[model samples]
Target: KMSFGTGHHATTFQMLRHQGQLDHQGKRVLDVGSGTGILAIMAHLLGASKVEAFDIDDWCVENGNENFDLNGLTTRMGLGTIRDVQPQGEFDIVLANINKNILLDEMALYADLVKKDGFLLLSGFYTQDIEDLTDHAKPLGLTLIAQQSKDNWAALILQKKA
Candidate 1:
């Protein structure tokens, strides 16, 4: 199994557990703020044809790569900001486990990167922050599908309108 090798919060793992069985067969996936790249690796396990991950911290890029190898999953890693990273093409699914402010700021970009009817999964926010998050994302044509909360953290699943 892959380990974070740092005292990171358990929310990331929780997000993975709550991500129900998905049909990612031959799908394209993008993981933002990939950290240890657990989510990206999980995407591959779920049968994503291609998984690309990005992180601003170089250490994360290295650690993520290590974890990917540990999991025996192949993925592409890059150093880039969420605002600067352009999606090569529309993805079937996009996952962002980031803070509320950053999520709000980049919601439009994330929305644009997903194909119509594609899904966007977001975590790293509190349940109390959902209203603002939903408000920010709605204008971009995203609809909330489900929400999973643990303690103070919450994850939201959204789908881009077709």
Candidate 2:
């Protein structure tokens, strides 16, 4: 299988670091726009019991599946837009690494998929975009917990308040 970690932006690595510290043991995770499924694979490695990922592109879905298998991850991969997915239940953690526009548009939906006090990690935005994204997320019951940046890219970790 082709490697999925080739030549991506440095921000991805930063996000991975934050994800590493979280306790994924027996947790359920959802990875949206899971390009190469890297984040999902990482979640599995962190001891998540189950990981489900989706992408709008068939190629990404296929590659993500392959990567998951290569890493011995039990993650499920599917092809569909995030809006098309109807999650069976709230997730312990949610990872989204898509563009800013899509992130903002889907904020409410993402909030609903998170369990109370669950973690929501979002990337694919620049530093300048944080305020707008946070402002949009506020009404959805998400509060900013942390932020990380590399180069021009940024990642925000939000939590659903109890």
TM-score of each: 0.90, 0.93
Candidate 2 stretches greater than 4 Å from native: 1-8
Instruction: Name the top lDDT candidate.
Output: 2
lDDT for residue 77 in candidate 2, whole number 0-100:
91
Residue 89 in candidate 1, Cα distance off native in Å: 0.4
Q: What lDDT would candidate 2 get against the real structure?
A: 0.85
Model 1, span 1-162: residue lDDT tens: 333423256467556854554568899999988878878888888888999898888888888888888878766578888766676888889988878888988888899899999889988888899999998888899999888788778888888995
- Residue-level lDDT of model 2, residues 63-110, one tens digit each, is 988888899976569888877876678899999888899999888888
Q: Which TM-score value belongs to model 2?
A: 0.93
Query: Residue 155 error for model 1, in Å?
Result: 0.6
- Candidate 2's displacement at residue 83, Å, is 1.7
Q: What is the lDDT of residue 50 in candidate 2?
A: 86
Q: For model 1, state the Cα shift of residue 65 in Å.
A: 0.7
lDDT of candidates 1 onward, in order: 0.81, 0.85
